[model samples]
Target: MITARREAWTGRVLLVLLMAITILPFLSLFVTALHPSGTYPPGLSWPGEPQWGNFLKAFQAARMGELLKSSTLIVLGVVPIALVIATMAGFAIGHLRTAGRNVVFIAFVLGLTLPFEGIITPLYYQVRDMGLLNTRWAIILPLIGLFMPFSVFWMRAHFVNMPAELSESARIDGANTWQLFWRVHVPLAMPAISSLAILLFLWTWNQFLLAIVLVDDPLKRTMSGALGAFQGQWGTDIPLLCAGSLLILAPTLVIFVIFQRRFVTALLQGSLKG
Candidate 1:
């Protein structure tokens, strides 16, 4: 009993230390962001007076309004279409008895192995050839394709674990494949779908490399992607830079906090089901 009690105490202490390590950087960042715009405070020292307006200054300086709009547009474009395609493909593979289904599923699984860095060069050239360079489509199209493998995999895991009797009963009721999918499976898959949407939103919002490389217009890139240019333009202003970073991070943080329960449910469900 004493040994087990000691072990539990040790674990609690270690967890507290780990939490501090994880949180300290962000705490420092928030503190630094509150410092006066032009002053570069050494280390993690708190400012004498917190400059709250630094965020507004940073927002205007970074032209964040346009960047936010662009990121929203990209997310809007990518998430819906990707979800639809992935869901259909997953349903076909998971629930249907189609020929060569294994082959098709393997093709998507193979896609998971192809990293963005591997094909980015070729992709750039292809987009250039198609006259999509420097456009939002350049980012949107590639992101959808890039997200497909994992999205399909995630949805397939959910569908495969769902009771076969669900589809079986629907078929006996004279429902067609489309009806079975839309009327039955889709409604039941809401939790997984909602989770997928949240993830896609986060991924699309945070996407940097493709946004920077594919689009030339700073206004057309994601907020995080545009941060490079923002940093270049205002690197010396440490407080301003930190403020801008916080602004860029705020939306995603807000989203995760709000939808945390759903996200956790999806992860737990997927793990148990898959």
Candidate 2:
């Protein structure tokens, strides 16, 4: 009983420390945001008159409504396609015994090593050539392509660990390959698939690099990209920036919080089952 109490105390301390570390930057941002817009203190004293309305100013100045709309559309567009493609590719790579499967898997693994910065120059030209430059698709396609490798590799690993006997049994019962995959394997692989979907959603939502490069039109930019523009407009408006930063961060945070339990469960179950 004494040992258990000590362990619990240790866990509580660790949790508090982690929470403090995670929240410190955000707290600092808030403290700055609450300060008077033009006369922020350098020494980090609490604001004399907390300007909570700076968030409104930041939102209006950044055209945050349009930015939010555009970002939502982009995330909505990319995530489903990425999930479907990754799921199919991962399943295929794992289940099929084709000669080039290892080669293909290796190619995907290599893709994880490729830097987006290195490919941006050529990718920009390619998008421009395809008439996708300046369009939302420019950002969407590139990000999907970039993230596919990691998604596929992870899904493949999960799928490969699933029992072959299940597929074999399905085949013995005369289930077609498609039927076996969709009806049997997919249901069994839900934990992995759910985990992947959550991850893909997070990645696509927070994507900034592709947004910066592919989207030149401010009206068509993402939340992250729009934040950059917001910074340009209200660089000195630290309070507003903080409020805006919190606003920008809120959606992803809510999403993670909502799905976090499922994410943890799915990942743990998938890994263990695999």
Candidate 3:
């Protein structure tokens, strides 16, 4: 009885500690956002007034609608193309017995180690030569290229863990390479696909360096890019900055809430597959 009681107490204490660690920062941000514009002493009662309208002000000043549109376009372009390329590359590497499959896979893995800074200058000149710089495609294409190696590595692990008999059975059923992958393997890999899509969406949406380096126009900037601009414009307004950050965080939070299970499970499964 004593051990059980102690264990329960310990669990409760840990839970409370964890909750405080997670929630306190958000609570402080909320309080700061609610703080009145005027001066105040060291510490006292909550602000008598809350600038709840700061959210709308953030949206207007950041031009959040255009930011959101650019973010959506970049994510939409990157995720689907990255997934398709990743799936095909993973399938080939995992299943095919080609002469240089391992070498090719290693080459792809090497891409993961290449720093963005190393390639940015060359990429800038290439984008300029192609006349893609300052356009959404500049950001989208670079992000897809940057993120593809990781996706391929992830999907390859998932495909390798899947039973060989699955693809064999598909082949026995008169399914060709495309059909085997799309109808048989791809459907089974939906969890990994979903996990990758969610991650890719989050990364692309939060992309700032690409937007800053690739795009000079305000209308072409994403939420993160717009936030950078907003910070420059409202350099002294901390509440507005916090409100803008929270607003930018909303979509990814909503996505995680909606697909938390698949996102977590697929991430684990992809990494842990035999």
Top candidate when judged by TM-score against the true structure: 1
lDDT of 2: 0.84
Cα deviation of 31 in candidate 3 (Å)? 2.1
Off by over 4 Å in 3: 1-19, 37-45
Give one digit per residue, the lDDT tens place, for model 2 in 142-236. Answer: 98899899999878988888788888998999999889878998887787888888888778777777777888887787788777777787777
Report lDDT (Cα) of residue 70, candidate 3: 81
Across residues 1-274, which tens digit of lDDT does each residue of candidate 1 receive? 9999999999999999999998898888899999988887888998899999999999999999999999999999999999999999999998888999899999999999999989999999999999999999999999999999999998988888879898899889999999999999999888899999999999999998998898888888989889988998999999999999999999998999899999999889888876
Model-by-model lDDT, in order?
0.92, 0.84, 0.83
Models sorted by lDDT, best on top: 1, 2, 3
lDDT leader: 1
After superposing candidate 1 on the true structure, give the runs of residues whose Cα lies further than 4 Å from its correct spot.
Answer: 1-11
TM-score of each: 0.96, 0.92, 0.89
Task: In model 2, state the lDDT of residue 66.
Answer: 87
- TM-score for model 1? 0.96
Task: List candidate 2 stretches off by more than 4 Å.
Answer: 1-12, 42-44
Alpha-carbon RMSD, each predicted model? 1.4, 2.1, 2.8
- Clashing pairs for predicted structure model 3, backbone only: none
Best-to-worst TM-score order:
1, 2, 3
Error of 2 at 236 (Å): 1.6
